[model samples]
Target: MFRTVVMIFFACVAGVATAEDTRLKRLDTGDDSRGWEAVGRLDIGGKGFCTGALIAPDLVLTAAHCLYDSLSGAQINHEEIEFLAGWRNGRASAYRWVRRAVVHPEYVYNGKVSADRVRNDVALLELHHPIRNTTVVPFATDQRPKKGDRIGVVSYARERSEAPSMQEACRVMARQSGMLIMSCEADFGSSGAPVFSFQDGVPRIVSVVSAKAEVAGHKVSLGTQLEGPLAVLKAALAQGQGAFSAAPAPRENRITVGTRNSSSGAKFIKN
Candidate 1:
């Protein structure tokens, strides 16, 4: 599915050969995960999960597809979602329930792998309460990086779902139709992971993981550029598009790695 999508785009544009990829380092200990407390795991409907990051004390940035059910093509109830900030080894720096969620208006979840779907596959999640922990500072976002630029990714995935892993260096292989093809390692449970660009030694978000794909037998991750879509999501939130009814009290035992279901919404590209 992804191969066909990427191949179509690659035929029209040239992509740089991937540079030496960086190995993922697990952040299992506090010392290793400090300053990265904003990246968390999103548990959805007790059926699966995805990666997410806090952009504001109350807003989380993730892929739009993460808010839907892959099997039914239906939006999951916001109350069924929870954000476990800086989740690692059965604990989290902060826990919050999703009070509201807003997907990009242009994004359509038709269960297809297309540039249009991946381009607008971004979402903003509003937490019921802000995370005011001093250690879990929210991350700021920057404009999208260019092709061949060095970037990083911190995400929770299949085998390492209990902890987040950082791939300190990866290259943007190509940019086409508002989508990015990156050499970062991503897999099931890695959707909505924040793609970071370190400028002057400070990390800022530039893209959101939409799906994982293969190009010429090489594994690559798909991402959405944040400049326009983020603004749209914020505007929708301000206009009360994300508002929801009263939510139930938060729970303590909702942290788990996302398991693959019928559609693998946010994680995999379907044919």
Candidate 2:
């Protein structure tokens, strides 16, 4: 039973690829980033980047693993973080520093990869200022996606860091133990990428990419089920736990969480 369970759970890094493209299309132009302005790059202390989405004018949601160091297991200072909305070719619709960040308490940084870990691999970031640009409107989030539900993803990954990409036809393969197995291709730096369901004809975040894995030779993506973990993180932020309030620790050059090794040769920081 344990072997079977493990087999069912250990899938791999999948990127956001559409049926039409079979690979992610870079949103390198204003036209490409049109409705995806809110999906931006979370530049972490100039060390690495992760994909994040603005859920509110001041709140960015991403994978919890983006908050820690993969080598030292230390929490990355929120002050060193910046959000570049609609980042494209050295430009952005808006830029803001992070004021506070809260990871799910249950999320163990640098912990072993597993379904339980993936389920809790979510975080919320509060920006120092709210982005009020008309073009960078925040996105709405909804309930988790069901099995086989068609979904979409927007993210930034290695070699594609200058801009984001959109994969409009990924599918949810299964849901088990609070983790989502998706057909979407998630590469390194894709951690915290939002999984959207277009059930209502409008995009709504349904999950946050946690890791990528492979099962039975089929590549797949892993993500955290959002609603519950998001709520917990919100409450934690309200209580001022883990918020960036003091001077950050001395900086050390190391691989950022979620960018180490995966199908795309990218790290999976959400673990």
Candidate 3:
């Protein structure tokens, strides 16, 4: 199913290819991860994890599918989620429990792969308390990158879950149906990883990893465009939709509660 999707995307866009992509560098040391403190790990229910970034002191940006149970297709309790900001070598710069979460209204976790799924695969998380550490700052979002634009990804995956890895040079291979196909390295647990565009030497998030895929034997990552779906997610949060809390009684103050893949032999998998 994912192979078909990748093939279709390749056919739709001409000259879809990666150029001089760099190898992944493990950010195992403090100095190696200095400016990327905002990119952190989302530990969910002690079952699995995903990558996420602080877009605001109290808000996190990640893929919508990260909020659901892959087996039950049910939304996970927000209280079970924790954000480990700048986690490395068994310690974190700051730790906070999730207070609320909002998935994109158009995203549906039906356990199927499709363009619609990838296009709307975004979510926003609100922390119980804002991260106020001077070293851990939130990143700003930017418009989606164009095809062939250079980008970078910082993420934690299955075998490398202890720390994040940085892929500093990758290209946007194509843009289709509001999704980006890029040469960035992604794997299981990399879902919700931020795709960064360095403008004026300042890194800004432009997309969020939705899945991992292989097209004609080359590995690629899938992501959602931030500009439109992100606006929708923020609006949903403002409108008080899909909010969850662990409190015994719902608080009158309506602020929080919260809460890919591959292509195969030419296939697709949610990271």
Candidate 4:
């Protein structure tokens, strides 16, 4: 009976992706979403987009504004950017690519300020050469997992001054609203991190880390649901020839949460 139970336990664990009981640092209590990748720098030779996992190889999901011209509402600017998988120093070399970028048609920056910021702060770039590296964790398509749901997040962000020299946080956090906002402190460079939920044993992205803000003097982050963009990106990824493509129209864009902007403070419903 013990052996049978052990086997069943292993089966259940296998059906669910592994997650750590990641400790909470100086946090006000929130979910931990781990879906992050390092693409290129964030300036001229620097910035383009911060990458995160999407289901398969060749496709990378990120912010829409990363690819557009902030001023013109034109098209993608950067030609080639490096995609680093697992993004460790010596283990794997970064993948270089001329990209294929797509932004949702509904993505529009506020015309008053910059066109691109409103253009849609999300995008999917298909690599010039398919990456034969790293596991491409799939996304949760359209379903939004509930609060207190354990989620995993991974990212290769700005390495600050420390022995680890890197600011990397894994483990999971409680979810808030329809959005999964974590108190994980990410910098400007970590913008497009993928937020994954280890549900039914597979790692699936439920949302993409979209913004960070100060709420009541505490740091908090937010991600729009993955379903909207993932649907469009999947269809575009299958195509491979366009600069950009999106799913059918009437797509509900991802939600926006912050201190005083769209959403009020966040709350989780115990399930």
Candidate 5:
């Protein structure tokens, strides 16, 4: 069953690390996952992987694009997706298959970068079972951070796909047209990584990595603000519009990747 409440609370209290002096630390060892057990790698049918965060024991937050096949552009089956919590050094605290997934109602998999697309590139994955381990705690979702606010990201990217990396020094460079331009470094396979804002000395997810772009000669990561689109996605899931059930779903019209090319303010590099 779907979890009614999506928010989560951790047991212990740790002061939020400031982004001023923090640098990206690769979690190649078990000790590196002490405070980031909830962040995981979402493997899409062994084709590709994206970063995801646990908002509820059964719910994973990631980019909507991660649910689609990169070559066929069709929505992948939930059974093909798996979430590996606290993945580091070739191990994980927990591994579970996805039962269902719901994308933002307004999101269109058009293979293009636009304000509207970036604004709604969020998705929620329902896990087959909840990860209730003592260490693998889910994170809480919060409102979008204001412009220039210090934010952090834990992600698995192209070169660093084996282990996740924590970048606590990233900042929200700008918020325009409902999208967040962040200084956080993102690359291929980093799509759907959570953008966290520290609240009450805890990490709360505010946005999700969608793409990496160059803005005004400055390379920045693009993210979808979670305030509005997340609600719509939850509603869709409540209505059973975009979720998998016991029976298999009919195949959707396949859309190929990188079909639409838009040369605008941000150069859309799929991450």
Candidate 6:
């Protein structure tokens, strides 16, 4: 299938991450209007890459594969890894770093038993100190949006196709797939960008950027499917963040983690 599976979420399937596409609409990246913050500035062999986010003062989330590299079919060294927070405008707030990172043990990047086959492209990062100004983690339940819901994307992407830049808002064309409808595009540096949906005057992060764009290139945006797989993720995420503190989704809301209704006009993508 030519899919690049990441080992954080799915078990094992070869070639399951990318499709054959690329031409996606770009969102405006003028000034990170949505206040998208980059997770870290990596010096990977003198080259930089993107990483997780501090949705709360102490809880950080990102694609598990980024830290471990379970998809390139390559071996990675873990001891020399580092994480930085509040990375923006070429100057990090000067006070952000990760004390510990726990990659999902079952994570797979490429062709191992723990292959990056499913693109289980998400993870939780715990910080040494809680971010001062950061409040509650702004994470929404892991679920795909309805076919035509309005959504937002915030990520630390490489600008000019070659530098780390953050994207604030981009209309998610389809609720679950297809292409994004903005210029604030993403790149290798923009994995794990939180995708939020606007509802009841609040923007809730319903998904995270998952796989690489399909070959058609419209920029396929895969939101997290919270209904079934989050049990493992929740437990994995709670190892240090205490508990997932998301408010119980409104009863009228049917897209919650464990529910059996879709009358609210909100539906969940199957896991």
lDDT of each: 0.81, 0.77, 0.79, 0.45, 0.75, 0.43
Clashes within 3 Å, all models in order:
1, 21, 24, 30, 1, 35
* Best of the two (3, 5) by lDDT: 3
Candidate 5, residues 1-271: lDDT per residue as tens digits? 0001111111111122223755678987767778798999998887889899999898899998887765555778878989999888788899999887888766766565566677788999888899999999999899999877889999998788778999987887767668887778777888999999986789999999987765444445778979788888777767766555443222324323234532223333343
Worst 10 residues of 6 by lDDT: 246-255
Best by lDDT: 1
Model 1: which ten-residue window has the lowest total lDDT? 248-257
Candidate 1's residue-wise lDDT over 102-211, tens digit each?
A: 88877877666666678888999999999999999999999989987899999998888999999978988777768888888788888999999998989999999887
lDDT against true structure, model 1:
0.81
Model 4: per-residue Cα lDDT over 132-180, one tens digit each: 5444234544365564465544544444201011222443233433345
Error of 4 at 136 (Å): 6.7
TM-score of 1: 0.86
* Stretches > 4 Å off in candidate 3: 1-9, 12-21, 245-271
lDDT (0-100) at residue 259 of candidate 1? Answer: 40
lDDT of 3 at 194: 94
Give the candidates in order of lDDT, highest first. Answer: 1, 3, 2, 5, 4, 6
Candidate 6 scores a C-alpha RMSD against the true structure in Å of 11.2
**Better by TM-score, candidate 6 or 1:** 1
lDDT computed for candidate 2:
0.77
When 4 and 6 are scored with TM-score, the better candidate is: 4
User: On a 0 to 100 scale, what is the lDDT of residue 242 in model 5?
Assistant: 57
